[model samples]
Target chain A: MGHYWQEISALTMRWVRRLSREKFSMLFTLVQPMLFWLIFFGNLFQRAADTQVMQAPNYISFLAAGVVVMTVLNNGLAGGVDLLFDKENGFLERLMSTPIHRTSVILSRFIFVMAITSMQVLVILGVAYLFGVQPATGILGVAMILLIGMMFGVGLTAISMAMAFSVKSHGDFFSVLGFLSLPMIFLSSALVPLTAMPGWMSVLAQFNPMTWAIDAVRPLILSGWTEALPHVGMVVLVMIVFDALCLYGGAKAFRRAMG
Target chain B: MDRTIAIDVSHLSKTYDSYRAVDDLSFQVYAGEIFGLLGPNGAGKSTTLRTLITLLHPTSGTATVMGHDTVRDADKVRTLIGYVPQERAIDRFLTGREHLQLLGALYHLTKEEAAKRIAELLKLVELEAHADRPAKTYSGGMKRKLDIACGLLPDPKVLFLDEPTLGLDVQSRLRIWEYVRMLKARGMTIVMTTNYLDEADQLCDRLAIIDGGKIKTLGSPVELKIALGGDIVSLTLKETGRISSLESDLTGRPAIKTVRATPKGLDIRVESPEKALPAILESANRLGCNIEFIQYNRPRLDDVFIAHTGRAITESIPESETV
Candidate 1:
């Protein structure tokens, strides 16, 4: 068990170090969503500051949580790109040839993705704070935001990794990414509130896991724990179920791949 | 030398959907000897190796590494073997030292033990000076050396090297040969695969030449060469018209066993090139076929392959097709 933990940490550090070495890419991944919220969405919804439709003092504050979750969504969903490349380059084959604990490979990937997701969440929140959008739950709100990101991120990362093995090539994986990325983002309340969306789309958002995460996070940033904690608890439950299913399938796919 | 078998793969078969990659393959690699799987691309060399290494499950059959069944006791087999895959597996971001340490940790080596072993391996592969640099900066040879070091980190009893020197230059290939020799000296059992005939000829103590998912022949290089019975006497005819008559004349001679015609010449296998030379020339002269060129050569692994398969082991497959 001790050896297992050490191997996991070692492999996790490998991913972390690889990401850190590419400073520009790491920074870009964290900053891309923040840029969208601050420059594009912030200006696009500048008039929403005077509107009562938004629950915050400024649109950026309301959009802040959404941007944080988006980072998690994008980064976590694309986490398996590394796995795909590793498989293609035969690096994964080499790793499997060793006598080490096999689960450590997938576990370390999850840890690495979560670690990056956490950093991206921080960056988006920090950038939003710089734009004068303060979370009503304060520093504790930052923790809540991270919790929301991770809860949502783990399930997505697991599915991504699973798909990385199940799919035939990068083209197939990218198509799935393309097909799912927009729907998950737009179908959720990332760019708009459920009330603002049409009746049919709003109904769809209700079932989208992204909506539950955004709904859970929005209250902490805009309203407070009074509104957020209940949703957070519910999202945690949903994520537990979601992660169990995804990780089980991911492990199955991983075993087939190793064989 | 321990004559005990380090690896015994019996009637191993691996199939993928409709394609059978390996078929009823049986071979034993003795401990501390460098055994080669000689074959062209797609001949199941990698599949057989993968099955033994537990990377791929065999559709049917059993392989034992140091007496542990590969399928049932895969973990035990893994602990006893290290594999250097055909493809280069080094991460570009990690320095050579980091790669070695990471593998060491995977094998559950202590930090002190990993460090000491990494130092020793770095020296063994002659990459000590470049061990701290990122592997991406190293030349092709350095990357391959680091890969070998990674495989050796566990100090396994058997090491599987799949096409270890495939894309290396002559000098780098020779350097790897030295490393292989050194490993053999230290009593490590090594199994390597290659499509290069000369590589198998020079490196392996014994080789199994696989073609079309079966071992065409298996023996030491010298033994296989000797199995061909005699030297190959090649004669280039000036005119192609009388070649058939000359071939018939040589075929009837007691000294010649087989005759084959190439685009440039005719090759006649004889028990003794020196003894058969006079009869071969006399037969050609009697048939009025002018001999443009004549040469006597020892039988090679290639000849052995041609003898069994009726075709030369061609080396013209481009790299892209290998994937």
Candidate 2:
């Protein structure tokens, strides 16, 4: 068991080390979410909603949770690109030929995604704070934000990895990724509140796991723990089920692809 | 003087949906020998190697490497063997030393052990100078050498090189041959697959000629060549009509072992072409056959393959693709 974790951590550190070496790409990943927050949401929605009615002191605090979730979503979706390229270039075949535990491959990818996602979330949250958006729950709120982001990210990363193994090429993988990422974002409350959307779309948002993650995280950032725990519990439960299903499905798809 | 079997594959067959890639294949590789799975593309050479390395599951049958079943005890089998895939498997973002250290750790080597092994491997492959540079900066031959070094990091008892020199230049290929020889001298068992007849003949201690998912023949290079007898005799006749009678006349002669009809001539396997040629001519003359040209020469691995399979090895494989 100790050795298994050693392999998983070694492989995870490999990705993290690679990520750190690509300074331009690493900066781009964190900067892209901040750009969306500053330009796409901040400038556009500066005076669109009332702070009192929206249940927040300001729009930036409300939007901060969304940016955090979006970072998780983007990182999770992009997580499988490495796996797909590995498969294409035969690196996966080399890794599989070793005596290492098979699940460690998928586990390492998830850990890498969560680590990068956590870093991006910190950068986004720190920028949001500097712009005068403070989480009501303070330091604890950051922990909740990371936990929620990771739970939601793990499931999506699993699905993305499953797609990576099943698809034939990067073209096909990106096509499916493009088709899923935007709709999941728009359908959820990432860029807008569920109440602001049309009735049917709002109901759909209620079922979106991203919505559960954001709704849970929004209160932690804006209204404090008093009103956040119940929603947080529900999101945690939903994420557990989601992670379980995706992990099982991903492992099965991976085994079939190996065959 | 006792040799143990390193790999034992029996009644192995793997079918991809409707196509049977490996069909009822069986063979044994002895410990401490370089074994070659010699075949053209898609002849099931890669399929067999993949199964033994635990990359592909056999549809039916058993493959045991180092006494561990590949399917039932795949992890054990994996621990004993290293595999260099047909395609390059290095991470362009990682340095050659980094790749080695990571792979060594994945194989459960301690950090210090991994570092020492990485250093030794870098030196062994002669990549010590460029070990710190990213693999993307390396040339094709350099990348291939790094790949082999990565495979060897674990000090596995058996190493599988799947067409290790497939696309390499002559110099790089010879360099790889030297590495293989050095590994074998250290008592490591090696299994390699190749379509190049000379690679199999020159590098392997034993070779298996696989075609259409079966082992057509198996032996050392000299044994296989010897199997075709001492020499090959080719006689072209002026009259193609007398081929059958001339073929039968040469068959079962005192010195001629076997006679095969070629498009323009009769090819005979003989103990001594000098002794067999005149008697063959006299018999053919009695049968009203006129010889236009005649040539005698030593047999080659290609001739051995042809004799066993009824067509030249490369001819049976379509020209459009070699895989």
lDDT of 1 at B206: 98
- Candidate 2 residues lying further than 4 Å off, grouped into runs, are A49-53, B1-3, B226-230, B233-268, B272-295, B304-323
Give the number of the best model, judged by DockQ. Answer: 2
Q: lDDT for model 2, on a 0 to 1 scale? A: 0.88
Question: Per-residue lDDT tens digits of candidate 1, residues B114-169?
Answer: 99999999998989899889888999999999989988999989999999999999
TM-score of chain B of each: 0.81, 0.80
- Cα displacement (Å) at residue B9, model 1: 0.8
Compute DockQ for each candidate against the true complex.
0.70, 0.78
lDDT of 2 by residue, A127-162 (tens): 887888888898988998899999999988989999
Evaluate candidate 1 by giving its C-alpha RMSD to the native, one decimal. Answer: 4.5
Among all windows of ten consecutive residues in candidate 2 chain A, which has the lowest summed lDDT? A37-46
Candidate 2's DockQ: 0.78
Candidate 2 lDDT at B314 equals 66
